[model samples]
Target: MANTTSAKKAVRKIARRTAVNKSRRSRVRNFVRKVEEAIASGDKAAAETAFRAAQPELMRAATKGVLHRNTASRKVSRLAQRVKAVGA
Candidate 1:
């Protein structure tokens, strides 16, 4: 459908970016899931550790434009709260 050479190149670039973004999003979800699973298992130490790992990943995703900054911060805040509650 793209008749122009530039448009064709743009379509290719978009496809590559889409793949990269999808991978990044999936990675973020996997990190979050790890934290949640640790929390659900009621292992405070593991939950805290997982939260530590996930927090950076979330922020990195935001930095990479995979997520909004506020969304990442909100997720970090909520997960931190849950991690704290796990110890209590």
Candidate 2:
């Protein structure tokens, strides 16, 4: 479908970017899931630890344009709340 040489190169670049973004998204989800699982299991320490690890990953994804800034902030805020609640 990409008839022009430049269009073909652009398609290749898009494919590469898509793969990278997909991997980043999946990594972020795993980090979030770890925190959520820790919270659900009622392990305050583990939840806090997981939240600490996930916070930077979430922000990194946002900075790299894998996620929106507000979306990452909201996720971090909600996870922190849940982690706090786990302690109470």
Name the candidate that leads on lDDT: 2
**Model 2 shows how many backbone clashes?**
0
lDDT of 1 by residue, 1-88 (tens): 8999999999999999999999999999999999999999999999999999999999999999999999999999999999899978
How high is each candidate's TM-score?
0.98, 0.99
Shift of residue 20 alpha carbon in model 2, Å:
0.3
Pairs in steric clash, model 2: none
RMSD of each: 0.5, 0.4
Q: lDDT scores for all predictions?
A: 0.96, 0.98
Backbone Cα, N, C clashes tallied per candidate: 0, 0
Please give the lDDT score at residue 71 for candidate 1. 99
| Model 1 lDDT at residue 85 | 96
TM-score of model number 2: 0.99
Q: Once superposed on the true structure, which residue ranges of model 2 sit more than 4 Å away at CA?
A: none
